[model samples]
Target: MDGGGDPQVAGPVIAALMERAAGETRVAMSPETAKKLIGLGATVRVESGAGVTASIPDSEYEAAGAVVGDLASTVAGADWIFGVAAPDVALLSGAKPGAKVAAVFDPFRDRARTDAYAAAGYEALAMELMPRITRAQSMDVLSSQSNLAGYKAVLAAANTYGRAFPMMMTAAGTVQAARCFVMGVGVAGLQAIATARRLGAQVSATDVRSATKEQIKSLGAKPIFVEKVAGIEGEGSGGYATEMSDEYKAAQAELVSSHIAKQDIVITTALIPGRPAPRLISDAQIATMKPGSVIYDLAVAAGGNVEGSEPDVIVEKHGVKIIGFSNTPAHLAADASALFARNLFNFVSAFWDKEKGEIVLDEEIGTAIRLTQDGKVVHERLLG
Candidate 1:
């Protein structure tokens, strides 16, 4: 199965492969994505049937100039490996000694697994750490995936709610639009606002960062906030919010409780990278919410914003429904895979040299996501 490759010499050719992890429905690369990667003058190998769950066939991959093979042959001597999720160490048994892997590895959540990847002599680029910067925008997997989640969250709420999102003029009587309140004005929250608005819902949003108020308003949604909070400034580096202090949390909760009680749907997207998701919705606030209200907590996997949310489950509490759909992007696997693959292709083509057939890891964003190098955990944040 060896493809006769030398690590230093073959760094230019990358294998956008797949994993056999059960229930993982997304593939890192599609047929069209393979074609784009090949245009960069790199030999691309796609494992046969890798994209099957995504509705892409082996013939399509081959037509796009990719070598179709089993996992062993596909990863054979490949210096670089790209995937939707990090492959299990067992899956990498046939990989080269120092193969570089780029994927959504959830580094902070699985510190031990990340350490194992480093100990196994693999250099990892955790796509979740892709910095929010102009240069890295085209390659930001988190935004691409989270954009899907935000839109879908609204749809999930709309579908589950007994009432309609838009006002209906029935012959019997006029029905008012559903009220939606989204907390967290990041990519997901903004998308949720846009989707809910499009569905004709009366949407309002809140964020710790006052800067996001303009953005929320731009989307025709009201920005709700506690004007004065002791600790939460809603400002941070790399275009994401930092953690809020206890004092700010207490004050914000008091302000939000009253507003939440009147809403029909509440979608919480507040999250701080490398930290447990903040509790934005309390048990008491949830109990007071209108009966039949829907609460979709996007951060449930990272602890949760709602009091009783569980990862990937839908449960009712206090006459209200809490929908916690884990890996939201994966629910829309085909389209999600397509967008994710395109982002992966952009990231690789950025550093790949066509004529010279060389790989350059000079992108500043690359350093941020690089979790291991030369058989050691290298990223400064991960070191802690």
Candidate 2:
């Protein structure tokens, strides 16, 4: 909590502000998470109704040892602020100086906001920047959330396709299984393949990373290698897909186009952080696809993998239906919130200092946190 100023404000004016902001104001925090914070010697100051939208009542937080406060007081002296979305500059400005803030911090999409947080002198941790190393696995919010996004992407695509995923048979004849082509075999892409196969689709997935081929096969899906052109590197730090060269992309397109014509559904999940999503499917390529086929772009918010895709809008061109979705994981809010909270907990555990009531950054953890620390962006590649 903000270390300065009297906890009991001097008079009615400050007390009134605290009263207005305090007591059972709803928050997204669950009881289990609230207890964890209290155990760490942090008090949970919530508005009277913060968690209502998430279905937990004010009484629930109080039962978990939280002291309800008005909005201004709750956030004013907060030692740390936790949220799913990147908080606005106004909220960060209100926080006591040097307070730690943790969130997804979509730096790629909201660089300006992050820059402002840096200017405000608050330590902002971007969970999305967690390293993809073995030691950092527990703290990886991106993979956890993207895993759900991948699962939901397939479900969304399945709903739009005319044919069923699995093979079926009737007295008349045997219905062949739907063919699914998945691009970018990252966490989400791999999940999409598994989900599609579970639904009985004959699934094939592609990625610049050769390592993903074995993973795809292990899930009982075929590994479709788009012709490898020059400059195709595999995976980057954190198991994220790195950018590919234009020549490599053209070759991939040629190979994918040939296979896509026969596919019943296509799910694309390739994304490069801070960059516009690589365009994998051209309008011409989509044109060759049969009518009633479905294409779901998981990177729709990053400008999409398919041509003519509009975020949250399903468009049809040349008989092929392209579905683009923004905020794919928002579809499973409760589950996503839980996983996200766990990631935050694990990350906070690494830095919290109980004795001093502040985070003590160890060498290793300091390096990790420095990936986006003190308002200066620092990554291995960026430093290079």
Choose the strongest candidate by TM-score: 1
What does candidate 2's lDDT look like per residue over 1-384, in tens digits?
A: 234344643111101011112221223356667777667766666666656655667797789876666667667666677766656657544566656666666765776766677677767667677767887788788898889989999899999998788888989988999999999988899889889988999999888887777899999999888554653445665577787777777777788989889898999999987689999999998988889999999988888888899988889999988997688876776677667767776776676776666556667655654434565655343354
- Residue 226 CA displacement from its true place in model 1, Å: 0.7
- Kindly report which residue stretches of model 2 are placed more than 4 angstroms away from their true locations once superposed: 1-28, 227-234, 363-384
- Candidate 1 Cα misplacement greater than 4 A, ranges: 1-11, 230-235
Report how far residue 305 has shifted in candidate 2, in Å: 0.9
At residue 193, give the lDDT of candidate 1. 100
Summarize candidate 1's per-residue lDDT along 1-384 as a digit string, tens digits. 223364333324577666566667899998898887777666788888888888888999999988898888787777788889888766776677888898988888888768888889998889889888788899999899889999999999888888999999999999999999999989999999999999999999998887888899999999998877643444576778887777877888887988999999999998888889988888899999988999999999899989989987888989999997877887888999999998988888788765567566775876889998778999898876
